[model samples]
Structures are given as C-alpha cells and as structure tokens.
Target: MVVVNVYAPNIYTNRRRLWDKFLSLCNSIEGIWLIIGDFNEVRVPEDRWNSVFDNNNALHFNNFIGAAGLLEYPMLGRKYTFLSGDGKKLSKIDRALVCSDFMTKWPNTSLRALERNISDHSPLILSSGASNYGPTPFRFFNSWIEIPGMVEAVNRGLNKQGNENFKDLLLG
Candidate 1:
C-alpha cells in the first residue's frame, strides 16, 4: 500500500505543477495508492458555493484526475470540506482519491467528513471497514528488491526463528 498526503498550493500554476509531478509518478506505482489532501481546488462547479468559480482550474483538476486514473469515493456526512472564515462560503477542497488498484484491493473504501472546530477546514476520514482474516500470506513485490538493504533484511528474516516473527516481519 502507498499513501500520499498533499497540500496543493492555492495558486493554479503551482497546483498544476503538483499535478504534473504526481502524474509522472503515478505510472511507477504498482500497488494500492491513496492520496488524501487539501487540494485547494474543486472538481466541479457544484463543489463550491458562494465562492468565485474558476472553470479553468476545475477543468484542469478534473483532467488530472481522469488522466491519472484516480477515483474518489463520494464524501459522506458533509457535502463540503472547507468553509470561509465568515461562514458564508463553502467548498469541497479536501478529498481522498485512490487508484483503481486500491479500489480493487479494498472495494469497500469510503470517505467521510468530520465536524470542523476552530479551523475553517473540516477533517476527512477514509475507511475500508475491512475485517481481519487472521494471518495473510506474504507476497513480495519486485520493487522491494530495489530498496537499499532489502536483500540483507530478507536474509536476516530468513535466519530468524518462529513462524509468528517471520510472518510479522514481512507484512505485519
């Protein structure tokens, strides 16, 4: 599993750069990917209320998501994630987006909004609601071999005693 936390800049140019960076990086990910963040942009006009709408920004944001093959589970408990200081404006700027690999691995994933306190932004919770099935078999990815000292780590694990420690070493 791979997790990415982002804080996209408010400016479109900077945000576009971030998107470009992520787009370039996305193809290399072979496992489940979850991206959660304050993106500072909306996917559509409906995502914002009482705020200036930017069609260009929204178009680019949607394009990025589509091009990257990212999926967003519908937000629950709230329609918006950000509120203006005066409480007049609302926008769904924060979200959790996953790759298809993630959805395939955890089909029950969900995104939920939590109550906002002092901050103008409300917190988001991403849940898979998966039940434990005891010990799962360990599966190694080819990418792990590229990491420094991974072979040494595996060798050390191979020498370790007991099934519990060995199982936990790889996937716990």
Candidate 2:
C-alpha cells in the first residue's frame, strides 16, 4: 500500500493548490493507497464543535475526497481528534482515508485515537493486522454512554465469566 502522510496548509488558496497536486499524484498511482494526516479542514459541519462552520470549505474538502475516490475510515475512542487549548473548540481534522483496494487488502484495518496529553491533536493508531491480539483493553468514554444500546453492550461484555471467555467475547 502507498501511504501518504501530509500536513495541509491552513490557508484556503494554498490548500486548494495542494489538493490539486494530490489529485494529480493520486491519478498517477495504481494499487492500494492510504492517505493519513492532519487535513486542517473538515468535510462537513458536524465535524466541528463550538466553532463557526464554513460551508465553502466543507464543499471543497468533500469534493476532494470524492475526486480522490477515498473512503474515510471509521475511527474509535474519540469523537474529535483536535481540541483547542482552551478546550472550547473541537474538530476531527486528523484522519485516515483509504482507497477501496486498500480496504480489500486490509479489511480489518482500524484507526484508534489515543489520549491527547501534550499536543492539541490526538495521536492516531492504525492497525491493519489480522492476527488475534487477545482481549482489547476496555476503555469507557463518557460520550459512548449517550449512544443507544451502549450501556447494554457494556453490561453484556462485563457479564461474561472467566478471562478467556471475556477475551473471546471482546475479540468477537
């Protein structure tokens, strides 16, 4: 797989130019492609919180993603990857986008947002391996409680007896 890590410019004009370049580059490549990094932009208004949404910017971003034929990989462990210093603004600016071929090769690939302790952005962990890795560490995110059936899911997980059984349940 071809993995491209990019840090896009904050300026809209510069970002547009860069996106064009990326499109050209993607066009020239063949095979699985994985694009990961801080895009400095959001595809939709829902991606940002406590901030003014820019419809124009969102349109540009969404167009780029569609043109690139990229799929936004589902993320776990956090609703947003970026947090302002004052903790007022939140957005998911960092993400992983994979082509369909890449998804076929690594069907179990996942992206996990690690704790953001020092930096403004959380570290993203990408795991593409198919090997069994025992039980996944149970992490309770307060935001998850808001989701319907999440509480029931947790209870069912906790109800499983024995370490092996619980591990198997989690892995399943």
Candidate 3:
C-alpha cells in the first residue's frame, strides 16, 4: 500500500500543475494507493459556505480525481472541515481519495472530522472500519418479552441447543 499526502497550493496554475504531475505519478504506480490532505479545493458548491465559489477550480479538481481514478469516500460527523478565524467562513477542503485497488482491499474505508481547537482546519481521520475482537456472547433482556415474537423465537432457538443452564435461566 502506498500513501501520498499532499498540500495543494492555493494558486490555480500551481494546483493544476500539481494535479497533472500527480496524475503522471499515479499512472506509473502499481499498487493500492491512498492520497489525502489539505487539497485547498472543494469538489462541489455544498463544500463551501460564506465563501466565494469558483466553478472552474472545482471542475479542475474533480477532473484530477477522475483522471487519477481516485475514489472519495463519504465524510462523517461534519459538513465542513475548515473555518476562518472569524468563524464566519467554512469549507470542506481536506479529504481522502483512494484508488480502486485500495477501496477493493478495504471496502469499509471511512473519513471523519475531529475538533479544530486552534488550527484553521479540522483534523481528518481515515480508517478501515472496526477491528475484529471475537464472537458475540448471548444476553437476554426481560424487556425483550414486550416484543411480539420474543417468547416464541426464544423457545425455538432454545430448543435447537442443549444448554441446560440457558434453558433453566430462560424458563425461570
């Protein structure tokens, strides 16, 4: 797996150049890849609030994602990841993009935004879902008997097993 962190420039020409160069690099690579960081750009109008929107810049940014065959996962916990000092302007600029191979390998990939205490940008977290611990243990709640099929389902399930303790506890 390859991870490439990028801090894109605010200048249109410079960011475009960077995108072209990065596209070339991706073409030559042969493995799962994850690219993330402050892209200094947004993919849609909804990504910005109380700020000017540039359709051309968004087009270029999305073109870069398409040309690189990068997949952007849905962000969780927040709508915007950046805020101005005045707390008036907000934008969702930081993101995580993965190649198809990486998405295939880690289908449960997700992105979340953390609190932005001091910095202008919120910290972004990318993870591949939960870690496996073990099988779940069974526990019965008395309140569950209020449900329609609770008693019958329990009786059917209990009948399939030979655990006398469970049978006694359930019956009592």
Look at candidate 1 and tell me the lDDT of residue 28. 76
- Give the C-alpha lDDT of model 3: 0.88
Q: What is the C-alpha local distance difference test score of each model?
A: 0.87, 0.86, 0.88
Q: Cα lDDT for residue 156, model 2?
A: 77
| Model 1 TM-score on a 0 to 1 scale | 0.74
Predicted structure with the largest TM-score when compared to the true one: 3
lDDT of 2: 0.86
As for candidate 2, its clashing pairs are none
Best-fitting candidate, scored by lDDT: 3
lDDT of 1 by residue, 94-172 (tens): 9999989788888887889999987888889888888898666677899999999989888876766766654446422
Please say which candidate is ahead in TM-score: 1 or 3. Answer: 3
Models ranked on lDDT: 3, 1, 2
Across 1-172, the per-residue lDDT of candidate 3 in tens digits comes to 7799989998989999999998998899787889999999999999999999999999999998999999999999888999988999999999999999888988998899888987999899998899988545577688999999889877876676565554644443
User: Which candidate would rank higher by lDDT, 2 or 3?
Assistant: 3
